[model samples]
Target: MEWTAAPARLATASADFEADFAACLHWSAETDAAIEQRVADILADVQARGDAAVLEYTERFDGLPADSVAALELSQAELKAAFDALPPAQRDALQAAAHRVRKYHEAQKKASGESWSYRDEDGTLLGQKVTPLDRVGIYVPGGKAAYPSSVLMNAIPAHVAGVQDIVMVVPTPRGEKNPLVLAAAYVAGVSRAFTLGGAQAVAALAYGTATVPKVDKITGPGNAYVASAKKRVFGTVGIDMIAGPSEILVLADGTTPPDWVAMDLFSQAEHDELAQSILLCPDAAYIDAVQREIDRLLPTMPRAEIIAKSLSGRGALILTRDMEEACAISNRIAPEHLEVSSRDPHRWEPLLRHAGAIFLGAYTSESLGDYCAGPNHVLPTSGTARFSSPLGVYDFQKRSSLIEVSEQGAQTLGAIASVLAHGEGLQAHARAAEMRLKG
Candidate 1:
């Protein structure tokens, strides 16, 4: 309803651009202290009481009546039935999305998931052995909505990497289950699924229960409670990453249509209250045009209030000196989604350095990457893109260092190891190397 309801306008020429941008980018990833303590209590309860606690929490939170956690398990036949029952168009779309996701991860496996070794002149074998996780629990959020795409994104990579057991946990609040999610599980080759969620589900995956097996790692995003639970159970079981709010940064060159850029910003803004959306452009006239378009289109969106809140809370329309300056600012933010909405995206892409996933050109919408795009949609949020990465086959697969020293190779390595170990005051380590040396 309000034209200026989106974000405030800022220009690099102003003295406060740096300060204003910093304020926009600030997002504390810390969980609420109360949530942390509550999660701790739930994890302890689950670990100590096992299936009983799981069932209690399931009933309390999800309002699902179940005598036992075992009863909540969905069979392979049930999953397949859900898939088969879908309307032709929906089923076809799900399959198409899954197929693209699978194809991309399969290529990723070949590129970075294979094991390799090289023998040295002295016959020393040095390499890395790549192996998929034995079992992993994927927590799909159900309280708000079902994400069939999430099922494809998380499970397809693990399946492609040869993970034997892909256990999925989805909260069936009020005894309701989304058939699309189950169908995705079937198509993605999930080994087991449980109608359980929250701290109990994560604890079951981390510590194991009578009905639920402990997983090697846990992946997927959830609410505050789930994020807190994941953090607490980390060392006991591996976790993907503690992601922050969704974000999008657009570096526009004023060539793309203003409406296209406005909708691009809205794509992330609608995700949640904390989600951020920003646009940087050198053309002041075009920035104004995009702002007008955002106002004109805001009321039409189903999630208008949310978009308005997110845009007003964290979004920005910044006018930079040039595209290069915009790219530099983008690096500093390291957004989850970066769109190069220019006539020639490649020209500015090389200037950009840090982003979870980059959407090039005006036609390549960030929405495509979230759904049908071959790339994994699970990406580092907030500024984690500076050091972290998009969830890929690498996240589901781990590596072990391989070292096999030949008899002659041992002589060469042993001498070096002995001196280094002695210098470090580790006598046993020195002697162990000495023992391997030929007399």
Candidate 2:
């Protein structure tokens, strides 16, 4: 069968541009009611029954029958063996990626993850105390594909942030464990590893089982069931943002090769049918070249069918009035990955804001960032990039405000606190402040 992938074409000056553009960007984040109900039932059952529920769900969903949860656990020695058994090239690549990730996060920790303090003239010391969570659970998607990159991205940062315990959960269908994932866990310092998935794994992480210890936060991507489970278990344990489909919006000035941009779009489109890939350029000729390349190259791709469906369904190749207009539209979209494919990327970069990650040059493909670019690939998807951030060292750490009020400082602060407390009609709060005040 012949396959074709044609994105919706639009011009900024068209009369129906606004309506069409909004329609193109529309994606409901809502999960099916049945999935939500199922996830709720699973969460409740796991929370109530603990290890037995997890074991049952693991067997039922994954077809990996386990007599006990302990039988499902992957020991440190097993993880190390997985790493050692890898081919020389695979081992080198995994170690290299882990090194870069660790270095980047260590630098991140130094920049914003560190504690700081300041002393006022009145001798009041105000500061912040930075500390890592006791433990964290990272859920790596193992159903459709195994992502060793995710293992590195999620666990390395927690390790760098001084998190004492990092629990990793990956779904291994029929007890088929991905060696690379296990190797990554070994390299990234996961304290515990489990072959568990779906809402049951999330419940075990969030609520804590007799075997799987509860985590302070759960971070990583998953299917609909996992996303819904994370949303439901938010207050019980902190969670990273609920991500949506992958997205890539390229802002081009017709300088970069059209084939490069086409392949970049394909990189995201191949993820799933719902993933979005878009191109915004002022040059009409360049837009045509990209579409031509996309059609010419689609047949050569192994995942061509998936790419075709994704591009046909959600992709767009928009022709803007100018690069500035493209930048404006990109900001509105707040894409998960924004590629500034231009000669002077920096010029347009300052104009662009609200992207999960920006690929700043022609040589910098979004895929590089996904693998070994020394940055987090676990980014905010859909349009959530407008307010959310990529997972980082800061995500693994918490802060406590430190205020040391001197006798002189207490008097001034006490007076202000007493007035505010009294104004709010809380006599007990007012009295508490008054007690600290100097007569």
Candidate 3:
């Protein structure tokens, strides 16, 4: 296939621009019937048979046999051994990334995770009490790829929030383990870990098996089956999100190098065939330059096939009337990662309000945010950025309202409650409040 072949082209000046843009943004997170049914059966089977079912699914799906699910669990000593055995360079990189992630989350905890209470004029104390979850499960995609970064992202935040038991789960297909993942677990302070994946792993986490203890919440991204499983087990246990495919949109003002922008698009495109990558610029000439750069540099990428399929399938090179129009369209798209590759990024940043993470200026690439940018890489994907936020310490904490009514205050509140309860014709409720009153 010719590398210079263009991606879908769109002009904001067109009469049917809205419809076209909507088409590009459309992606249904709903899993297909077969995957949903399979996930349902797996979740139910694991719930019923516990460790035996997990073992069965792990063997059948991952082609790994374990006498017991407990045998699949990696001990802390093994995790630390993996960390110790990594080459010096890899060890330093992992430690550096973890340190930065931990520092960022510690700051996040100070900003939003503290408990506070205040006494009112009536001498009644009221405020929110912040508490960390007892336990959490971090799912890292394993087998073909090892994302040590994901281990740091999910586990470190919960650790910062003071979660005592952080259980890590990864699919080690055919008993092939990634040392980096285990190393991350050791560094991030995971209390337990198991070699498991898919709906069965999620089910094991949601409903405690004999081997895997149930967690207060589950947080991480996964394949379609994992996504479906997360959604199914939501009410039974809290979940982070049913995340859609990855996406990135760049708003260029013809200042940054076309090669840089082209590579940025390739970054998200290489994630999967359905991942979306688009560039919106007023300069048609610059857009053409980026297209050429895409053609030239794409052949060099190891995942060229995935990048090509992603670009041709869902990517676009859009022309807008001006930067203002570009920002307007970007808000509508509410992309996962929005890069303002311009001279004065801040000037456009105020106008660009909706994105999971904004990469500013000519130098900032979305890849930095994914690794060690001090901010969370676990962002809201698809248009969920319009309403949601990046995963943080807050996601691992819960709040409770504290109320200590003084004697005088109770008298005042009791009369109000009695009146309302009597008005609602609930005599028992009125009497209960009246009992608190003296004389």
Candidate 4:
């Protein structure tokens, strides 16, 4: 079947540009009410019945009937075997990606993930103690496609952060396992893995089954059920973020080839129908050329239908006043992935402040960042990038403030504490502080 791609075209100077832009950018992140309720029930059932519930759900959903959750577990030897069995190219790629991801995360840890202390003149020591999570569960999607990269991106950072146990859960529908995924688990240093998935898998991770150990946090993306389960389990355990549909926004200066920009847009549109890919450029002729390239190149894609639907529904080709205006608009959108496809990408990059990851210059494709560019691929979506960040070593570690007071410090601190405690009408707190004050 022939596929067509026609993204909405808008000029910033047009009076209706605001309305057109809003319509193109709109995507509701609200989970379906039915899915939410179903997820709640699944979480409750798993919390109550533990392994039995997990086994039943795995059979019903994944078509893999396990006698127990233990039956679903993937052993270290199996992971190693998967790695050893891979073709040399696959093995080399996996190891190389893991190495770069590990290196980047190690650098990230050294910069921020550490314990520090400082002493004041009064001999009061104050600082922070940084520590890694004891255990974390990373969910890898194994439904439509297998992502070995997800395994590396999620687990490597945790490993670098010193997480002792990285429990991996990948839903293998019909008991079919992806060797690449298993190989990635081995390469990324996953401590434990299970051929399980869906909200049931999430429930097992969030609330410990008899066999599945409860994790301190859960990271990685999944389908609706997995997302809903994560939302329900947030208080019980930490979650990376509630991700939305993938997005890529290109701020073009018309210097890059139209075909390059068109393919860059296609890179994200193929993710799903809801995924968005937009181009903001000042040159109307370049925008026209890009649209022509999109039309010419889209039909050649294997996922051409999906790209067509995504571009027709949510994508845009906005003609901005200039690069400055394009940068401002990109910040307003705060897209998941932003590409400055321009001659002087660095000049515009500083002006852009709110994307999950910025790919500077035409050559830096978003796909590179998604796979092996070192920085994490799991990023905040749906304008969440405005405040949050990409998944990194920090996500797998926590910090605690350290304080130690000497006699001299307490003497001064106690008097101040006594006044504040009394002001709040807490006599016990006031007396406690007053008791420590020098007479």
Output the number of the lDDT-best candidate. 2
Task: Point out the worst 10-residue segment of candidate 4 by lDDT.
Answer: 20-29
Alpha carbon deviation, residue 206, candidate 1 (Å): 0.8
Q: Which 10 consecutive residues of model 3 have the lowest summed lDDT?
A: 1-10
Q: Give the TM-score comparing model 4 with the true structure, all chains together.
A: 0.99
Minimum summed lDDT over a 10-residue window in model 2 is located at 430-439
Where is model 4 more than 4 Å wrong at Cα? none
Q: Which residue pairs come into collision in candidate 3?
A: none
**Model 4 lDDT, full chain set:** 0.94
In candidate 4, residue 6 scores what lDDT?
85
Q: Which segments of candidate 3 are over 4 A away from where they belong? A: 1-5
Q: Could you tell me every candidate's TM-score relative to the true structure?
A: 0.98, 0.99, 0.97, 0.99
Provide the lDDT at 298 for model 3.
89
lDDT of 4 at 231: 89
Residue 108's lDDT within candidate 3 is 95
lDDT score for candidate 2 against the true structure: 0.95
Instruction: List runs of model 2 lying over 4 Å from the truth.
Output: none
TM-score of 1: 0.98
**Candidates sorted on lDDT, descending:** 2, 4, 3, 1
The per-prediction CA RMSD against the true structure, in angstroms, equals 1.3, 0.9, 1.3, 0.8
Q: What Cα-based lDDT does every candidate model obtain?
A: 0.92, 0.95, 0.93, 0.94
